[model samples]
Target chain A: MTTYKRMVLASRPQGHVVPENFRLEEVPVPDLKDGELLVRNHYLSLDPYMRMRMEDVKSYAAPQAIGETMIGGTVGEVVASKNPKFAVGDKVQGMFGWSEMGVSDGSLLRRLDTTHIPLSAYLGSVGMPGMTAWYGLTQIIQPKEGETIVVSAASGAVGSVVGQLAKLRGCRAVGIAGGKEKCDYVVNELGFDACIDYKAGNLKEELAKATPNGIDGVFENVGGEIFDACLERMNPFGRIALCGMIAGYDGDPSPIRNARFFLTMRLSMRGFIVSEHMDLWPQGLKELGTLVATGKLKFRESVAQGLEAAPEAFIGMLKGRNFGKQLVKLI
Target chain B: MTTYKRMVLASRPQGHVVPENFRLEEVPVPDLKDGELLVRNHYLSLDPYMRMRMEDVKSYAAPQAIGETMIGGTVGEVVASKNPKFAVGDKVQGMFGWSEMGVSDGSLLRRLDTTHIPLSAYLGSVGMPGMTAWYGLTQIIQPKEGETIVVSAASGAVGSVVGQLAKLRGCRAVGIAGGKEKCDYVVNELGFDACIDYKAGNLKEELAKATPNGIDGVFENVGGEIFDACLERMNPFGRIALCGMIAGYDGDPSPIRNARFFLTMRLSMRGFIVSEHMDLWPQGLKELGTLVATGKLKFRESVAQGLEAAPEAFIGMLKGRNFGKQLVKLI
Candidate 1:
């Protein structure tokens, strides 16, 4: 009998999640039914939004139930299949959770085309995180040519793509990251116009120096003081696309101090979820796929070893310890 | 020489303005130059936005310079004229400041026709304040038919027009006012769907009772606690047109505590100034004028005696002591 390992939510966390909160268990692989397929997960995706789902609070999505498998995106091979659509040895990607194997009826899974792009690009730039960047930039910010855009969490999965896309659209892209290392990577490697190291002192002064023309668009991720400082620097008719506030996920939500600028400068601030706009996914995927395959768009990843490392990797991601898209490579 | 009484800014107030902050002075009306017309002021418009001008801070308009005549809208008749566009004894309206008589170049003045719509209504419902209501409602909220809209400071000039216009658009109008009397007038006289007395206590409960289906649109004038309470009751994808924030204009700006809901609910909030959108004014004025001329839009006034009473009336209006549009009758 084939056996597999999977991680389940042991309990809800109080402040920061601990390893004890997730229980790694072994289970026998069930036989595939007439229309079902058994796939071995090769990789697992970890993101900041998963931190919100860990808590039983009012969020855009429902909380993760206890004893249930920790849900996430995965790319793997169809080792056994009785389904007509997915054949044995076919590669597929979907939300298959933190497990060694996933049984599917081939509904949510997408067949992979590994000829141009790697199998892992689907989880970072050409997948959910990539689509998120696309929706926020195209639908909300929609910065015009020569306009300036400031994106927080600049070296991360979603923000990296946002900066690259803005540059491609003929706009000046400024990024805000944690350290000198990440900042350097963002500016030198990612080809962003400028990258402000937020961890260093005098954030407001640094931002002012970088954006002399005033910020016309903001893609906010880290909420607290960073969001407030960026808001004060916005020009008239500035547009803000609210994405993530990972700074507050483990603690009290950040209090936006300078929202009064909304009136004085006549700003437009909107918050959105990528899942809510499913119609834009196909278009986003097509563009993201082409860019990644053509070597025009670039991405980086910090991968952990196995399913047992997902809890620690996820916790580290919230703290911004991981450099880029935090993924777990499983076999 | 013709002399007139005018209210000038004596000094900037520390917290709230008193009558001492304004000085009533008699100045000899200057001679009308070429293309100039001398106007004998009949009515002066008092609005909340004028308070923003009183402070020497960064705002949409320049600060009211001490010892200068306080800026405001006025409606009057041309007693003497040299310009062919304006004739003697012709009624006119423009920015004539807080003066009983004004000398104009006939450049800014518009001839009034009180045959169908009352001239005072031009200062209240079919004028600048009315255009503010139009631009915010149409451009930001853009509520669908049968959507619920909550208007704060509902009995005042701008807000009264907001509710009346919303009702005309086949929307459910909900008003929030200070006292029972103003609330009664808002519901009984103005034909609003419901009115909440914010002063009666149980504000949360009252707002909950009023907006059972959840607030789809909010026309926010009075920010602070009232705005916080309203934001909590808003439905997903709610749109807020941020106008005046009178509640916090005196001391400190209100801190938005529930701004995180912006992301959870996917809300779109935008702030606007009417003068900035001049292109929409003609369209807005035509519709507003028709509404008032046909008696479809109703308005009420709390007229103060003369230019000397302007400061006291304005202070009273800020304290919610006025029933409707607070005006200073200069004739």
Candidate 2:
């Protein structure tokens, strides 16, 4: 048996999750049974949704229990395989948790072919985050050409893909990011029509200038004040795809008192977990892969080295320290 | 030309409209121009929408002017017709205002055929109010069979029709009205599954009792604490067809805060003006007429005797004194 380091949730957080909430421990490597494979973690994805799992409250996904390894999606290499589908040295991506090594019964893991794209891209641009953006924009919001589309957290994983896809569809894409650097990346790098720095005092005015005719579609990633600002400038028959509410995840839930605003605009706002749309994931990946290969899509990763840094990377992502898709290189 | 007494908006109301806000004036009857008809008013429809027209502020419809005759829909008889489409003694329904007689260009009037149904039924059951309920339920909310639907202002014109339609579709309909009498009318006379009297204490608990499965569809007419109660009991993917916010209309401009509740439930709340759906009125009227004639739909009218009593009926409706659809008879 081999030993590996794993980060486990030490306690449920009340407000913001700190390092103390997680404990890094050296644990015995789990034994692989028949039909199971052993995977050595290569990269770990840190997502805003992890914050929800850290809470003990009921949500779309099950909460991580105290003293259990924190749940996460990871790109790993199969070092030992008793399963015929996955051979030794075969790369895969799955909910393998925040660990250096793990034993899986081949339930959640999908065999990743590195010949088509880099294995790390399987956890970033061509993975769940990319699929989330595609399904939300195409299925839920269904934005039309020349329509003004707004995405909160625009420089982040899902929002970045959403903005780029909106632009590719001939729609005017406006992004709301935290700082000038991320804003510039979204507008200049991603070719978005406009990027508003939400941290700036003039969110309402900036949004007005960005979308003169009013926003027709919104991919809501960060809710709260941004949501409030977006509501004021939405056009009649606008659609809102509520992918996440990261702004209120870590903080105390702020009361949203804007139902009348939504009513008057006749907006259709819907929230959905990405897992609910898994059937369309292959189609999403195929399109996104083509875009990435053709240089029509761009992606960035804020990679933290080693598995021990997963906690800090997660905390930093929640605090808006990461520029794009936050990941931890565990090799 | 004959002289007729008309009610004019002498002043805008700060809150609920009072008799002092309206001025009674005798104006010379307008002569019928080419393509026009002189209509002698019979029954004036006293609707909640009239209150919206009284405000100087912009809304879905243009506000009534300070000295202009008060706007309303009326069932009338054609006394003189310069228009070929209409002739003397023909009964009709039109935007005839709160007056004994008026000349219409035949553009705003629809000839009422009493052979199919009663003339006043054109103003209530198969008219704008009926169509509003039909569209709100079928197009906006679209409740499936066995779904629990709740409607506020349940015994009022729009709500009464909405509850009956829901019942026809095999859905459980719960209503909120003013008193035990109106509540009884909603359940027994109109055939709602259950009815809650807002005058009764513990609104939230009462709503919970009425809607044990939670509200799948909510036809919102009154929007204050009742709306708050409905929000608390909304099921996932609930839909709200917002026809009016009568509760807040007379009291405050501040909208009710139900955004967070809506987001969590992933609710679709939409506000629509019935005027936009005029093209579908024929189909709606035909279907509703069949329902009423076949005894599947029932409607009640609280008719005031004269034009002078219209103000009192309207005020009573606003104060939750009217049992059902309120109307004024001038003939």
Off by over 4 Å in 2: A18-20, A53-67, A254-256, A305-308, B8-24, B50-59, B63-66, B251-266, B303-321
| Per-model TM against the reference | 0.95, 0.90
Writing each residue's lDDT as its tens digit, candidate 1 over A141-226 gives 99999999999999999999999999999989999999999999999999999999999988999999989999999998888899
Error (Å) of candidate 1 at residue B284 is 2.3
Model 2 C-alpha RMSD vs. true structure (Å) is: 3.0
- Tell me, by TM-score, which candidate is best: 1
How does candidate 2 score on lDDT?
0.85
Residue B180, model 2: lDDT of: 93
True contacts kept of 2: 0.30
| Residue range A1-331, candidate 2, lDDT tens digits | 4799999999888788888999999998777789999999899999988887787653555688889988989998999988888899988898879988888888888988777577877777799899889988999889999999999999988999999999999999999999999999998899999999988889999999999988899998887888888888888778888877777778556434454455456677777666777889989999998888777889888999997788888889987899999999988
lDDT of each: 0.89, 0.85
List the pairs of residues colliding in candidate 1: none
